[model samples]
Target chain A: MNLIKLAWRNIIHDPLTLFLNIILLTLGIGLINFILLLNTQLKDKFEKNLADIHMVVGAKGSPLQMILNSMYHIDAPTGNISIQEAKPFLREKHPLIDKSVPLSMGDSHKGYRIIGTDHTILEFYNAEIHAGELWNNLYDVTIGAEVAKALDLKLGSQFKSSHGFTDDVDLEHDHGTLTVVGVLKPTGSVIDQLILVSTESVWAVHDHDHEAHDHEGHEHGDHDHEEHENGHAHNDNEEHDHAHDHEGHDQHEHDHSHDDHEHDHEHDHSDPNHHHYGEIAPRRKVNDLSREHLLSQTEKDITSVLVRFKSKTNFQALNMPRNINENTDLQAASPAYEINRLYDMMGTGTKALQLLALLIAIVSAISIFVSLLNSLKRRKYELSLLRVMGGKPAKLLSLILLEGLILSLLGFFIGMIVSHLCMSAMGDSLYERYNYPFKAWIAHGKEGLLFTGTILLGLTAALLPAIMAYKTDIHSNLSEG
Target chain B: MLSTKNLSHSYKGTQAFNFPDLLCQPSETLLVIGQSGVGKSTLLHILAGILIPTKGEVLINDTSLYKQKTNALDTFRGQNIGMIFQKPHFVQAVSAVENLFLAQTMANKAKDTKRVHTLLDQLNISNRATAKTYQMSQGEQQRLSIARALVNNPKLILADEPTSALDDSNCNEVIQLLKHQAEAVNAALVIVTHDSRLKDIFPNQLELN
Candidate 1:
């Protein structure tokens, strides 16, 4: 009976065309919203994590890869640079350098990167301890907030690190198990996705991998002398001595954990007390590795160093990256510059998708217009009858316009819901791969504009048809029948 | 009562029409019979306030129909005059009851479902009250239009070619119902048709050449 009711009824009566119009509009709006979410969230995450690190110095490779690996932790590192090589930037008070934090990355536990770093990294990211304390002893690890929640790691929980940033069991280091000493509060930055430990912990784990053979040789010599004094020939010990003389030395090659090597060597003999120690080899405290002791041998290398400049002056800003990249064997990259380049590359694709979505919306608007015009043409007599029965021109005009508004509003709502669901589905996979905390349900500010734009499109498409309804010559139209 | 004096309308290139003076009191039925091109429908439309005549004015219940502003005139038409077209027209989306309700709403009357029901019952369409107008038998559609026209209890009722497609018996039944409904509301009735068979039926007649 009311104008709106009548308009709604008319739209329902033509279900096939109604479906076409609404579906087109929904696809247009949904695609646009989806593209908006991806662009905004990715930019937010990339920029937020790029905290004042003016340069990254690493082994010579792609500068972008160095930035991504060091600053964002999403790509493979560009090899390692010797501690002695990075020593200048790592100094306590350099004129041009405000601070430099070394990152020793090459390991992970459950797909979360274990980044061996100092306490200053916590300051750089503005992160705070949520529980327990910072890692101070060898094999002690501090976890990110997301890492703790995702892996269900509590203080004192222990896990062995894999050799690279993946959870492949084959690559799990025979290095000693690392104990959780602390959990960090989330800073909405890359720190929330990293596991941090003292840089010496990384060197110590690698040292154990290479030195297990040397310790085996020295221990074998002492045991041989003891056998000679006791006048006893242990066949297993003889076989071990024979195997150690060969070049392969496959037993200790993969059994690189020092404790595991000692356990294996002791297991060949018949000392009950030593056998008990063998059983607890993985739990043995190999805790002597400290930052001072490890850096005393400056040949030990780190993955990269994140340097913040004292001032972003024109001279240093223009010269620092070039000096490091050209003069030294290390690759130096500006995190901000590389990230901006990345955003520009991605922005092109996002703009294209936005344009395509806009085109679809325009086509959808036309569909609405054509369908409404057709409905008006078919229902001219009905309109005239309204005019004859005390309906005004404005009433008829609004009836047609109401049909368009109602149709587009339905399309807008359904489109938004569909886009959100699609985003949530994609967000889970993206988070797993990149560790970016993408909140899929957060509607951005442009969506308010999008809402208004969609309504205007609907109304604009309905305008001409509504005016036609308003200007209908009722007598001529009625008498045509 | 309804009356028209010196009423005429012209198209852009056609000769102008000159209409005779006419009068009909409340509860009285007047039939205007003519051929297809005689502009009988035009005269009815002018009287219904659907057309502005080139000359002269139509007066209904002593109020000149065209004297009010366009919207006010429309509201006045809704409140006081009812016109049925040659073929029944309806907002095809709604049921018979809803269409009658729409008619009363358009006329600026508070929705009177009881009046609609009573009219549908009198027209023998109460059983089809919830059916869409287009889905009904043609006879039922015509009766629905009658219900719509009388829904507001208007002071004047105009029917244009009300029974052109009907048989003699059906035509007689339709005219009688129109006369009865008009008399029940004490409204003036004007019937315009190219159907000459209706010339002898009404007591008052106006013939358009």
Candidate 2:
């Protein structure tokens, strides 16, 4: 029989001690590998979604929360700042700023955030439209890859928006269901989970909510809804006629949806804004999203403005947050700075877990050494019998060493499977909570070092026992037996 | 043939031994009897090529065992010598057939399953070939041990206290098996033990004081 087969036989025959050794080793390696997977993926995803944007300008509060809300979309916004105040940064070519995209949120569908961003977000994330075209009109929606897969949305699929970002079904907006005009390919960023539309869509939903306060009488509002469906009205005149229909009390239902049955889908209009852009009746002039719309709405606000500088060395880079924090009511947070702080705060817990895993590994090494040494004592006569026949001293030594090596390699593979299985078991709940998809198996180069280290550990543990086997007193052991 | 001349041994912390010269022709069995303090194991170790004597040489077929380098001497021992212990020690994790396989491979011989099975059948323990050594009764273990020793077709076979752990009936059965296997392989056999029951069985005997 070969030395390896002989060694394997020896290991399996003494199951209790070797089994304990393998269990400790599996737990040790499993925890270490699990931590590495979590750390790498968390760092990769956080860094990838940064997308080279330098500063986030929003209402002043916790700077970290502003960066998280604006860049990562994981937290409630600090507050909203006027769109007029962020206009200087959003201009086509400001001197210090490379580009800026304004974000307005506070609406969702089934826990996935619906963000009102224009084409700049698609350009910023380098996302391609996978199935259909980008939103051509105000309320038309372009869905992210993950959002489409999760919600089973498709081109021409329609769904109603909820008022807030949380997934409470009770807060569903009863006005109009948003239409999916496009789907974006997977970008491996936060954009993969968002439902994107023009900024006016968010304002229109809230502006309609605000118009319900101006309802004249419930009976008259119900009357206007019936006449709108019964009357043949053009898209431009429906809003003017819905003026009388707009004064609803408890039930602010208007049948403007019926007036848009003849709406066209062509995006070839020279005028950037379309008829349905302000197709809802305006209780006030601020709802006029026509030409010069943004200029006239001085009271309108956006949640945050994402700013990338023209150059890293711009004096603005050194002075931007400080300047904004001291002089303006708006807060400007650097994504890189805030994210590093987040990692440092998380590193303490990861370090403690890693230390525990290392301790388990050390204990496992001791157990392996003790187990091998114990087996060597019991197998002394057998080793001597080998020498009595034709075995060299080196062969006996290698046989002992091979047993330890074999057990350790087996434990390492089992530990790797354990780690991946654990990750997969935690995957669905983690995705439900944070919306980051974690796969069960992701291989990297670091495992190669782990393999070499395991071999070294096994050999080191077996060294003393193997030497004893090498030096076995053949005559004395055989005679003693 | 197996022979040893001037086979004496001594070391720093152990008693010195000056052994009688020994010679056994092919198909012959020799017995060396001794008390517990008479260095019976020492003589077996020197003759088995495991120990380099203070001053002596062991020969098998006219090739001096100790005259070769240490590694070559090991290969020579594997090719020429087989050993059996009194209590029938084995690599207990492996099967009886595998132990026989180990004997052949360790002795630098080609694997011969037919030779192994033939040796097992000759010992009349062929049914226990696939059983682990620990699973066998003491009598069956002793027979398997003999099968292992003869599997390599060695030039010299040494049995250390082979009948010391056996009853009178078992002792006679084992000694007969040893002599028959040695005659079958045409190798010289030597049995060293303090057991008096073996006195009448082997006629060529040496008693150490």
Candidate 3:
């Protein structure tokens, strides 16, 4: 009965035009929303996992790949550095170091990377064992909440791991079956999708001296597997014997009193000439220690070392990574620097997509204008009749304005729904592929601005048409009709 | 009551029109008869406050219409004057009853569905009240327009050639309907038309040359 009611009638009089306007506007707004939601979540995930890790120490390669591998677990490691090479930073009492967790990767279960680190990794993720207990020994595995849910792993479950990062089941390492000791609670971090095991477990899986490896008779010549395996055995021996063999591989074979064991281990370990720290722990003779064991503990190499500074304000912390990069063979990469570089790379695509979405919105506004203008011309006499029925010129103007607003609002709502629908669809595939969570409904400040812009677009498009309705010559139109 | 004096209008590059003075009391009916292009519609528009005459005043209840601002004039017209076009036009999307509701609402009057139903029932078009305006026949549309004009209970009703498009019998029926509605509301009625038949029906008549 009011101007708005009349405008509603006028719009519904031609539903096709309204539908067309809504579809175009929805597509534009939906695209904008989709891009915004993705970018926000991606940046958030990157920033969250980049928490407090000042530097990544790894074998020389792409720094970004190193950070991506160690911090986010999204890429392959940049080869491994020997324990001796990483000794200073890993030392508990080192001046610049607060804590250091070593990671030994290059294995996967159904494409989810199995990360090998100490108990500190749980603290790093702020994770809790929601069920059962954390891994306590070699071959004892604890899965992330997401990994447990996705792979349907449970307490007391056992699964053999495959060698290297691959989805193929054919490359299964028959060395040992990792027992599921725990399932961590959801931390909303990258830890949710990781399969966590002790670094010793990683070395044990590759260790040849284990009876299981002899039973399998697999050639242990794969250096990546063998070096990492001895590191695992040394870790085991440290746990039982308190040999404190945290630094060198010689005490590993010397403790077993195997000169034959020393022969194979010495082949790789003796290239570096240095004092064997593990041999010093047992007060073993220098003649019993191999030179290779002096450079690396257990003759093993780990993927990377995650370093936390004693204090961020410490000057030594600032100088340490640089010294590691310039003076040592190992490379240092900062998660913050590499992630910012990633954002810079993705920013251009986001901006271009945003522009395209805005252009679609503007074009939809034009369609609204045209549709209203067309309706106005057809309803000219009807409008004149309204004037004759004692409607003010302003009333007629408001009628057209209301119609435009209704169309815009309808289109905006439909656009939001469409965007979320697309997100849900894309989110499912993305989760399946990369384990990235994309929630359907995510409202932000930018969307609020988008709503305001939609209203403005609607009202602005109606301006000329409303003015035309206002200036309509009631006398002429009535006479002609 | 309705009155007009020295009412004149001129279109750009066209001849000027000079209208005779007029006066009518409440419940009075007047017909201004003219040929096409005699500015009969122009006179009706001026009386309805839809057009501003080049010279003169249209006084309703002795208040000069031309003396008011555009907004005030519009409000005054909405509340006091009801107009029926030559053709029975409407907001075609709405129902016949809704058309009456529109008239009441536009005049800043509260909706009275009871009164709307009563008016349509009185006009004998209550059966078609819920039907869209386009669905109604010609005579039904005209009667609905009459119902709309009377819905607001205005002080004056100005209809332009109400019978011009109707047959002989339909024309007589429409005139009787308009007169009865005007008398029922106690309003002055001024109808301008080129139809000669109306002159026989209305004793208060003015002829435009």
lDDT (Cα, tens digit) per residue for candidate 1, span A194-278: 9998775664454333233243445444453343323322223233332221111212222232222222332111111121111
Could you tell me the TM-score of candidate 2?
A: 0.88
Task: Please give, for every candidate in the order listed, the TM-score of chain B alone compared with the true chain B.
Answer: 0.97, 0.96, 0.97
| Residues B1-209, model 2: lDDT tens digits | 98889888887688779898999999999999988878788888888888779998899998998898876777788878888888888898899999998887776678898998888888888898889889999999999888888888888999998998899888889999999989988999999988888887789998876
Q: Score the docking of each candidate (DockQ).
A: 0.76, 0.70, 0.66
Q: How well is each residue in A1-481 modelled by candidate 3, as lDDT tens digits? A: 8887888888888879978888888888888878877887878788888768888899899999899888888767787776667777676677777777788786788878888777777767788899998776556788999889888999988887876666777666654578898999999898988898866556545442222223332233333234434553444334422242322443344344323232332222112221112211221222322223323454456778888887866887777777888999999977777788888888888989989999998999899999989988898998887776767888888888898888888877888888888888788766644445667787744888878888889999999999999999988877777
Stretches of candidate 3 off by over 4 Å are A109-111, A128-132, A148-175, A183-186, A206-298, A310-329, B12-15
Instruction: Estimate candidate 2's alpha-carbon lDDT, on a 0 to 1 scale.
Output: 0.77
> How do the residues B59-143 of candidate 1 rate in per-residue lDDT, one tens digit apiece?
9977898888999888898889888766888888888899999998887789887898999999999999999888998888888
Query: Predictions ranked by TM-score, top down?
Result: 2, 1, 3
Best-fitting candidate, measured by DockQ?
1
Q: Candidate 2 docking: what grade? A: medium
List residue ranges in candidate 2 displaced over 4 A: A163-168, A207-296, B13-15
Which CAPRI quality tier does the interface of model 3 achieve? medium
